[model samples]
Target: MERDLSCSWRARREAGGHAKGGKVTSSDVIMVPQIIPTDSVSVGRAATLALRCTMCHGARGMSEAYTPNLAGQNAEVVYKQLRDLQLGHRKSAIMGLHARNLSDQDMRGLAAYYSYLLRETPPSSLLGQRKAPRIIQVGSPMFNIAPCASCHGGSARKTASSTLEGEPENYIRAQLSAFKDGTRHNDINGQMRSVARQMTPEKVETLAKYYSQR
Candidate 1:
């Protein structure tokens, strides 16, 4: 299909004709199919890549404290982060090295590979969908904290924001701590920092455990 498309596109370009009836433009480039199908990035291949990635992140994209778990995360999110790292918008020595060498296809493949991984759910999740913990469900009005569920996709729905369900507990704890300390300011308008600032240490730990178990 790709070969045929390429040939057709070349023929059209050489003939100086528009694409069928419509005008041809750079946007038409998207009409060309990728050499590799998105579905070809399988779990096994992802795991193999993860092995190369396991020094800091685990074999399943589960990393230690302060590292993110890539399993079951949104593919676009992963792709954007990789792009950011490559462009120096985000800073991480390890990620910068990995992203710098990757082509656009590699980023997409990695995204698809990690997005499809199956994460283990806690027993509570098996029973049924669960609600966010009280702290996440109801924001502290006095402190001007927004409800975490509103933006993080809540416990009931997965949002474009990173999915926290079944992620490593330590990672969540560390991130919240970072947000509180103003060390991590990636969130737009300092939203995470604001929310974390209002949360006590005990509350932060509670929120971490609540989502980790889900």
Candidate 2:
């Protein structure tokens, strides 16, 4: 089915009826142009777009290794990430190269395509049922040193920040590690670095495991 993306506004006539020389009573419906999806392209382009994403994000936009799971993500978020990669605001050696080659339309197409895939939640094992090191708990302090649920759960989760649900444990841990150290420093908001710096190796593992299990 086609989607209609538009904003609706309500209008009403003045109260007290139309005055002699003051006002007029009238109501009307106005149609504003909206950003709607048009089938101006072919399936071949879609297939190629998916293939381009699959080269790193996996065939289904779900990476098994250190890469993130992009399936079922918000289209805007995906588009922003692609733009960040291209602008050097996000650090990804491989992604940077790939994004640089894509046009704005290509990025949008990929984002829209991937946003429809099934979203995978982190494994339950990482949600904190298992025992973890004491240092991690002490150093991190919030969410038992686990950071996924904090920003990605409440109001913060709905924002531009990527959701942690259904992501691979290894990928989460790697990112945390990268943020903690100086290996990755392209966060436009600097939140990742701030959060990662407080985490030690033990904390990283505990949190990673916790998120994995969620």
Candidate 3:
């Protein structure tokens, strides 16, 4: 299984060209619930605002590229990420540039608009508990690793956790690698980074593939 996983991970990396290298960012952004847009948010305004993002994030928030699908994601999560990008807490050249111009209201509107979209990308079970890979569903007790699903999946989903199911495999893998390598420290109090460090590269690839298939 390890051999197969290594081969597949290399193949995907070579073919995808999904992610580049990273640098460690010291995030001082606090973890607080965002004042997300309500149901009354103006979709037209949000659509107009998202026009600048279409080239990379797709016409409707779901990306055919290696980026994540924003449809059906938590509004709070979306707003927080935008805020982080704007504040220089997260490291993304393209995202930082686009986010720099957005006001608080603009971020909320975009968050609400994307969250309101019907989740049809991979048709994963967004409304209920779904089967997950063992590594995500249950962590390695001996390694003191926490399960990914505890905070980012199913009924126990945390307040600011981003949805992972149906994201691109390489995107997931790349982010996990960033966490493991100390190149992404935007996670609250290093929770994700700590868990990721305990996971082997093969395990990371397995987890990424499992979610991508959902």
Candidate 4:
């Protein structure tokens, strides 16, 4: 089955990277099959390349700052994000500079290597997901919003959705705010934007605190 790229990235590229007011995450490259190459060369290249990434993402792929952790992150998700940055579909000052010079193989290799690392365990202080707010566990269907867990809770997640468990509260809040304000429209099919738009700022704060510190 083929995916459509006419919406944003493809159109932008075809229009010489100047398609105005219709940007989206550049997931067009993964429309077909999505697989990370684990071959020795690819892995070695990725490992070597990761030397530059470790400054922010930690030597093991977990960041000490508010940045997203790359350890055990979904390979496809990481790959798409990098591609988006390279294609100007996503905006990040630091990442854009780094991804600007990365080749296709470099991106794939980096993504595969990061996913190969072990994930950091959540701290004991973190609260149980069961005790989360009603909107986080079971969304308000009256507003047509699905549970945050449906896509970001780390189980049976939708394609291309990022994992939110054990993430930084500040980071989660910022991204949620971005989505709510349409600043982060990279989410596939506007799923995140739609969900965030319906949530109140207070609800966003609550959700962030629950997912991060509980």
Candidate 5:
């Protein structure tokens, strides 16, 4: 699996012409062509043409390790993140480059494409409780941390915030860490940063596991 993943990324890099051995300049960024018109209902097709997104994010939008799964996410959340990447409200070496050439309409089209996909696996409790995760039930009032469910809806729905029930563990952990360290500040009014700053590593791990298991 590791080798296959490496090969997949390598192929994508080579396809982007980044394999040329030289300092990466601003002009080296790859720009995929938009195929479908924005007014059409073929936004998914357009996104596939503009960005072979499935090369990194799975075909069905299930993601591996550091990539957050986009399946069943709110279109608004996905579009906002892409916009943030493009506008520098969020920072990512790869995503920023990919987003730099995208227009607002393109971002929305791509978001719509991913948001409608289904997850590889439905989330379930590791202990078979079929109930909310423990962290969702209890929050540390001492740190002014509200229950996650308070912000993220309890059901399988997405809001301005992401739908976290089935996100990748490492992705969630990394984002939490970013928020804690002040590197990811896209959350409105620093809400995530505030919560993450008050959370310990252990708490972050627990939350990641709990949510990933759903």
Candidate 6:
């Protein structure tokens, strides 16, 4: 059955002018039919991926601590990260092995699946009442280290490139720490590293708490 399916796909490709060894033209790049199998095996694999992912990422991708909340993350970003883990660009003992077993289709499906999850909003009071040490205030005056909203706020804010409305605070802090310690120095633009280095331990905790509350 699999061989038959492969032959059929090949035939369709040839019909669309995609010859095995011939020079390809722009018109030959027609859309191929999506061939995801709706069998028990596929469903089981997807279910397993969801279950395994939930253990660390959270039931619906809303983690309580350090683990990144994958709910509502950009699908492309998630997909690329999975690919990076598989390629060794991203280092994770567990994630690298897990990503290795996943096909491109599986990665895309997982990305799409997690991206659709609804993000949980944190309490406003928690964000409003969080206090920080006085030194952070004087040290990082440029970015407003205490109040997370200072840099992560309105359209005109310093880091207004992306919205931090529903992201996981644990993930945010992890990235910041990674930047500071140089464990995750893959950021070519250097914006994240710069921000992370400027933040003290107190400031990281303060912002993490404040963002999590929001």
Highest-scoring model, lDDT: 4
Global fold similarity of model 3 (TM-score): 0.79
Off by over 4 Å in 4: 1-33, 123-130
Q: Compared with the true structure, what per-residue lDDT tens digits does model 6 show for residues 120-176?
A: 775667555755434323435665333334444554344112335555677778878
Q: Write the per-residue lDDT of candidate 5 for residues 62-106, one digit (tens) a residue.
A: 878889888777666777678668856678999899899987667
Higher-lDDT candidate of 2 and 6: 2
* Cα lDDT computed for each candidate against the true fold: 0.64, 0.60, 0.72, 0.73, 0.67, 0.57
Report the lDDT tens digits of candidate 1 across residue range 44-163.
465566567777767777666667778778665576567556754445788889889877667666777787776656676453666666778887788787777777764554333678
TM-score winner: 4
Model 6 global lDDT (CA atoms, 0 to 1): 0.57
Clashes of 6: 0
| RMSD after CA superposition, every candidate | 10.7, 13.0, 11.7, 5.3, 11.6, 11.9
Q: List the residue pairs that clash in candidate 6.
A: none
TM-score of 1: 0.68
Q: What would you estimate as the lDDT of candidate 1?
A: 0.64
What clash count goes with each model? 0, 13, 0, 0, 0, 0
Q: What is the lDDT of residue 190 in candidate 5?
A: 68
User: Candidate 3: where is the Cα deviation over 4 Å?
Assistant: 1-34, 39-41, 121-131
**Candidate 3 weakest ten by summed lDDT:** 1-10
TM-score, every prediction: 0.68, 0.65, 0.79, 0.80, 0.74, 0.60
Model 1 misplacement above 4 A? 1-37, 41-48, 64-66, 125-131, 154-159
